[model samples]
Target: MSILNSSALRPSSLILIGIPGLESYHIWFAAPLSIIYIATVLGNVMLLLAITTVLKLQKPMYIFISQLAFSDLVLSTCAVPKMLDIFWYNSREIQLSACITQMFFIHLMLVFESSILTAMSFDRYVAVCNPLRYHSILTHALIAKLSALSLLRAIVVIVPLPLLTLRLSFCSRCIAHSFCTNMAMTKISCADITVNNVYAMFVSLFLGPVDIICIALSYSLIVRLVLRLPHKDARLKTFSTCSSHISVMSALYVPFFFGTLLTLFPNRIPVHVHILVANTYLIVPPLINPLIYGLTVKEVRQSMYLLLQNCKNRIRLWASSRVWR
Candidate 1:
């Protein structure tokens, strides 16, 4: 009887109102999103493999980039599948615990990736602005230390999310979007979310502004140095190298900043718009980041092609061995 009653009490629909009046948009969202999900995963996986196998990409820049690719990979994997599930199957019913879990990882990855980008920006500044001092400043030990710190920062800052979420019992388990996002999930909690709200807002303001400002400042100094170069060709080379990173930074940050602002005023903006924009914040970077580097960096692309050829040859050898066996 108790089991029956508990089962009966569960929310029937995952969506609050089932995707608004945009029924037509479901096809648009589904088809493209599925492609994006596949491409993001495949692209990042290949990049990871290439980084691991190729000796040339073993430097600090590639190490940081591999970390960036990895972070974006996880970020997309966590957020995109749930979205597709929601859109395709109408499986909106996520439990409270699962919601909290998703929120934790999602936020953790976001902060960690942002920190990695900051590190990468600083790396660029050192490599270009102070080329003579670059190697000594960005030693292997220093890179390793920075990597550890980035991981630690992510763990520490994200610890509060799960702990605080555990304290608050949810009233309704129906998340508007596909995934259980920190800001969206918190809004639906019946308990006084004063602590969670304040902490989230604080983290956003502090971490976000500091990262953006620091990155901008790094680029500003780098720009000045690049301009001081006597040869126009040398100046262009410096700018060209940084262009890919700059493009990625802009794409990743702009949507995220806008989405954060929208969350602050959730009531005014229609829920679907909020959800789509928020989803975009998670989606676009993962899809385009690899392409940016692959197209811009000649060596990375060549290495990636070589890695694929090696994979094909290995498969062929395995097949021949299997036939002989």
Candidate 2:
């Protein structure tokens, strides 16, 4: 869309084409996507409550799990409603400023999610590798620092996207994707985008690759230690302890890199495929993360079950206490 006249002024807003090549099916697509969004919200919120309300789940490990749930909640919530608006309501016009804000939060949550996963891996490593001092090392002060640092790192890294975006002038105020990303915005800019391109590469590498490396390193050490255990039962238990996290990490990073690759090879990959990958990357993690943790981790399942039973009993009590007469 950069085919506009060099003198054309930047428009105040951009029009998004919700899922290119599938405009005819936009409304049809809305049903399942809306259901997914609703389910994601409920799942993450349930997991978040389970972690926070359960006394046994107040440990540092579960603290990280809660952060993951919260991150997924914000991540999906940040983008899905707007996307549904575009699809269901045909509300395509997004103010340039608001679009930039959306871009900021979406990426912020993604980066923060990566940091939280890395923190989780570190927690597991410490728990398995240094069992006795797990509590002492992962103190409240340290957990608070790690949590603060996760948000601070996310902000410091992602905040520059909007600042950098301000310097560019758009050739066309039309975005062809479901949401605003650095690449989507840069694609339509009239200005020389070498700096933007370089910075985007830097941000992608910084946010994703660095976090992947840290997670990998942590898990490798944990696995190595687990391998040296004398008893097969202990080894099985340690692997079981790690399976849920590994599943979560795969759910996060695999599609992320796949989407990035699709974005990079835009000509080779179909546009709709790239968009689907991007949208699913944001949505699936929130939906499946709770399932992964809730089902795999016995304590979380028990907590959620208890919470449900308590709610059920309260309803019965409230119904019985009512003055029918």
Which candidate wins on lDDT? 2
Pairs with steric clashes in candidate 1: 14-92
Colliding residue pairs in candidate 2 = none
Worst 10 residues of 1 by lDDT: 1-10
**What is the C-alpha lDDT profile of model 2 across 211-275, one tens digit per residue?**
88898899889889988999999999988988999999999899999888776677987799998
Off by over 4 Å in 2: 1-6, 317-325
Report the alpha-carbon TM-score of model 2 versus the true structure. Answer: 0.94
RMSD (Cα, Å) for all candidates, in order, is 3.7, 2.2
Model 1: per-residue Cα lDDT over 49-165, one tens digit each = 888888888888889889989998989988778778767765655556666677888888899988988999999999898889988999989999999999999899989988986
lDDT of 1: 0.80
